[model samples]
Target: MENKLMMRLVIATEAILFISLMITYVYFDLSVGFTKQSINYLDIKSTGIFSVLLFSSSFTLVQAEKNYSEGKIKKLKIWLFATIVLGSVFLFGQAKEYFKLLNNHFNISLDVFSTNFFTLTGFHAFHVIIGLILLIIVFILTLAGDFDRPNSTALSSIGMYWHFVDIVWILVFTLVYVLPYLLK
Candidate 1:
């Protein structure tokens, strides 16, 4: 019970941070207005694909948790691995996008829009990294026979964090990627 409560508190705090970052992003973006130079190289289609990949990971994670509860250890491991792969792919996509932006001279140092963009996404990425680490630790513990029906508290906590990360990404994607196009 305490574990669950603490996890919820942590997620709630993280949510506030993300909400603030998003508000700042929108405020700056609207203030500056969308210029061709501001978002010229943003590949919405590619980002959409990446978003799909990340969202699907959440589905896989849910399956993993369900499998664990059902005592299907092998299936749980497989689903957990799938979640990790999907998350890593999403991170790779983010890195690729960042490289492209930097190559095009769009960087955090450039303007308020760029700064907020990077800070928000970068913070989210950091959370993803933390999730990945948690997933990996849980995976190792499972492999060592440390997790069972009665020993799944840590796994459940990590699952909550993973789902939280996915939810935050959806919000960020909508605000940063989709909203700008619609607003324009």
Candidate 2:
């Protein structure tokens, strides 16, 4: 109960952090001159693809939890592993995009747009990394038979967090990707 409460608190704080960053991005985006064309610089289609991959992990995670509940340990491992792969693919897509942006000279110090873009998305990427680490640990534990009904709290806790991260990315993808194009 205590751990779950703490997790909820942590998630609330994380949501606030991301929301603030998003608001800051909107403020700067509206106020500043966009010297670079976002359409040309950002591959929205590829981003959408990666977003789908990340969101799909949520389903896989639910399967993992369900399998665990049903005592299907091997299936739980497979689902957890799928979640990890999807997450890693999402991270890889982000890294590729970051490198492309960097090569285009869109560094953190470039301008307000660049600054807000990097800060918001960078923090998101950091969260994704943390989620990946947590999931990896859970996956290893599952493989080692360290997870069972009595010991499933950690997995459930992390699953909540993983789902939260996926939810945040959905918002981020909408705000940072879709709306801008529509607004343009």
Candidate 3:
């Protein structure tokens, strides 16, 4: 009970953190007044592909939880591993995007757009890295027979966090990647 409550509190704080960052992005965007060409710098299609992987991890995680409830240990492992792989690839995609921007001499110091863009997305990527680390630790614990008995709410707490991360990304993706391009 205490752990679950603590997780909820942490998630609430995280939610506020993401919301504030997003609001900052919007506030700057409104002030800067970008031209249509600005959206062209972002490769929406490529990022969308990677976003799909991150979204898919939510499903895999639910599957993992389901398998755990069903006492299907092997299947749980497979699903958890899938979630980790998807998250890793998503991070890789993020890094690739960063590299592309840097190679083009685009960076946070460039202008308001770059600064807000990097601040918002960079924080999101940092969250993803944190989630990946947590997932890895859970995997290690599962392998060590820590979750075999599953007496309490260990797995579901992490699941809540993983789902929250994915949900935040969905919002960030729509705002940063989709809406700007489409509005153009």
Candidate 4:
């Protein structure tokens, strides 16, 4: 019971953090004097790809949790491995997009709009990286036979975090990719 409460608290804290960041991002974006010329260099298509990959990762993670609950160790590991691979791919795609933007001089220091854009999306990327690391740790534990128990709270907690991270990325994708184009 206490563990469940603690998990809920952790989720609440994460929710607060995400909400604060979103508010800051929106405030900065609206206050900035961004002409279409300033942000024309952004590669929205690449970001869309990364967003899709990250979202798909959450589905894979859910399958992994289901396998874990069913005591299918090998299947759980495979799904977890796939989730990690997809997450890595998403990170790589984000890195490539960032490099392209940098080459085009759309860096964080360029202007207020660019700064806010990079800060928001960059933070989301950072979270994704952290989630990947956590997933790797969990994967290692699974290999060590540490998560063989049915109804493992640890596995469920990890799944919750993974799902939350993906949801956050969805919101970030909407704000960074969709909103900018629509507003312009």
Candidate 5:
């Protein structure tokens, strides 16, 4: 019960964090001119692709949690591996996009748009990195025979966190990638 309570607290904290970032993004966006010229300067296409990848990683993570709950260790392993791989792919896509943006001189220091853009997305990327690290730790635990129990609360908690990260990406994708294009 304490663990469950702690889990909820952690989740709530994460939700608050994302909410704050979203609010900051919206505030900054509205403060500036909503002109097509400003919108066209962003690399929306690359962001769109990264959004897709991040969203897909959420699906993979759900599968991992499902497998873990069903007591199918082998299936859980496969699904977790899939989640990790999808996450890695998403990170790689983000890195490539970042490099492209830098090469094109769309750096964080360029303007209000670039600064906010990089700050929001870069903070998200940092979350993804932390999620990846957690996944690896869980993977190692599973491999070391630490999750052989019939009902592992630790497994479920981590799974919840993984799903939460994915859900946060959904919001990020909508606000950072989709909304900008639509507003443009």
Candidate 6:
């Protein structure tokens, strides 16, 4: 019960922060307008691919939970490993995009678009890294027979967090990549 309550509070607080950043992003977009350079520089296709991978982690996590509930520790570990791999790939994609932007001189300080864009996406990426770390820890613990029991609160808590991170990515991906591309 305490674990769940703590996870709920963390999720609520994080939701507020992400919401504020998203609103800030929209405020900048409406106030300053997205410059042609910014619009043209946005890579919808590549990021969409990564976004799919990130979203898939949520499903893999569910599989892990199912395996845990059925007393299949090895299967649970495999699913968790799959979740970690998918999330890592997504992060790699995000980093690749960041490097490409920096190489093209489209950095955080470039303009309002760049500033808010990086801020919003950077926060999301940070959350992903944290999620990855948590998942890795859980995986290690499971390997050591720490979570052999069915009532694993740690796994449940991590599931909530991982799902939250994935949902946030969906919103960010739509706002940063999809909406801009469609409107342009």
Pick by lDDT: which candidate is best?
6
Q: How much is 174 displaced in model 1, in angstroms?
A: 0.8
* lDDT of predicted model 6: 0.93
For each candidate, what TM-score against the reference?
A: 0.95, 0.94, 0.95, 0.91, 0.87, 0.98
Query: How many residue pairs clash (N, CA or C atoms closer than 3 angstroms) in each of the candidate models, in the order given?
Result: 0, 0, 0, 0, 0, 0
Cα error, candidate 5, residue 112 (Å) = 1.0
lDDT of 3 by residue, 99-150 (tens): 9998988888877778878988898888889888988987888888776755
Over 3-90, each residue of candidate 4 has an lDDT whose tens digit, in order, gives 5567678778978888888888788767765668766777778778877888888889989989988889999999999999999999
TM-score, candidate 4, is 0.91
Arranged by lDDT, best first: 6, 3, 1, 2, 4, 5
The predicted structure with the larger lDDT, 3 or 6, is 6
lDDT tens per residue, model 5, 34-147 = 456545666667767766777777777777777777777777777778778888888898888888778888788877777777887787888888878888887777788786
Candidate 2 structure quality by residue, lDDT tens digits, 1-184: 6667788998999999998998888777778755547445778899899999999999999999888888888999999999999999999999999999989887888777777778888898899899889989878887787776645477778888889999888888887788777767
Candidate 2 wrongly placed segments (more than 4 Å): 33-39
The model with the greater lDDT, 1 or 3, is 3
Q: Write down the TM-score for model 1.
A: 0.95
Clash pairs (backbone) in predicted model 3: none
Against the reference, the lDDT scores of all candidates come to 0.86, 0.85, 0.88, 0.82, 0.76, 0.93
- The better candidate by lDDT, 3 or 4, is 3
Candidate 5, residue 77: Cα displacement in angstroms equals: 0.8
Candidate 1 runs further than 4 Å off: none
Q: How many steric overlaps does candidate 5 have?
A: 0
TM-score of decoy 2: 0.94
Model 2 gets an lDDT of 0.85
lDDT of 4: 0.82
